[model samples]
Target: MAFQSKQSMTEPRDRTGAVQGIEGVLLANRDRIVRFLEVRGAGDGAEDLFQDLWMRLTDRRSGPIADPLPYIMRAANNLMLDRYRSARQRELRDKAWGEASATHAPSSETSLISREQLALVETAIAATGERPARIFRCFRVDGLSQRDIASKMGVSLSTVEADLRKVYAALAVIRRQFDAS
Candidate 1:
């Protein structure tokens, strides 16, 4: 047919063996592949992944595939999965970096971990005896001055000071343990 000759003249053919069929199938299924990626949570990166698929498809030498469509589709799915894994890993790395570099604010707020810390401090302070524990609660919780705390507890100012020093020594040991862990 003269029309076949004219068509062949107008269109370029693949000089390479298997790439010709793959490129043809790729071009035909590009839209489907992109949609597939979006549905797999690729979002706006679907187009980028499609381009990646194209580059990767042509990356290695291969013989002709008996089932090019499934092969190409599987490759696209695998590419999306690879992207997901890489993004997940990046997020975890960034979170770990942020936590490691963040300033430690022990008194800022209470979370579950802070509750455990509160328990530890309570245990250490309780070990100092009832007088020191009451003194600590009055000074830190009631925001009372040391002289007022000594007056309220009917003790000398130096006794109050000594009780506070005991509390401080116990707390400093807990601080060292927290930092080491």
Candidate 2:
């Protein structure tokens, strides 16, 4: 029998019976995998998932899988699910922490300083002018977006942005004076 090439024997083969490295197979199918992930609701995270797949494939040593496409797709799906679960857990943990912290009252000195700071901020916003003060209240107190403020006030978006900027500048000056004192 003729001597078989060592390279041919050692190289991984796909379901098609063609010899290819796992990396080569994965690289060739990268675009298809990303598209699959996007369809599965990964959106802009498709590329990131693909990179994770690449790392997983490269990091492990295993025998040639008869069909890697399905395997890869499964891995991507699992990774996406893991990320979603992790994000949900993190959000819950943060909410719980925030609630815990909110229950604690500040020290008397801290409360007094906070009240004084609020008074200074209010004074600074009032000094800026009526339009700026209203815009500042709409944003900071009402938590309205700039676009909402502009639309509600029948002003250009730029006007709203400018008002906010003026308010912010005045506040910065007040803050600097307070820090100096």
Assess every candidate by TM-score. Answer: 0.45, 0.42
Which pairs clash in model 1?
none
Q: Where in model 1 is the C-alpha error above 4 Å?
A: 1-15, 101-181
- Candidate closest to the true structure, highest TM-score: 1
Instruction: Give the Cα error of residue 91 in candidate 1, in Å.
Output: 1.3
Q: Model-by-model lDDT, in order?
A: 0.76, 0.74
Prediction RMSDs, each to the true structure:
26.9, 19.0
Q: Supply every candidate's count of residue pairs whose N, Cα or C atoms clash at under 3 angstroms.
A: 0, 0
User: Candidate 2: where are CA atoms >4 Å away?
Assistant: 1-20, 101-181
RMSD of 2: 19.0
Tens digit of per-residue lDDT, candidate 2, span 120-140:
889889999999899999999
Q: Mind giving the per-residue lDDT tens digits that candidate 1 earns over 1-181?
A: 2212232344334326567777889899889988988898789988988888899987746555557778888888888777665665565456557788554422322232356878998999999999998998898888899999999999999999999999989999997786465
Best by lDDT: 1
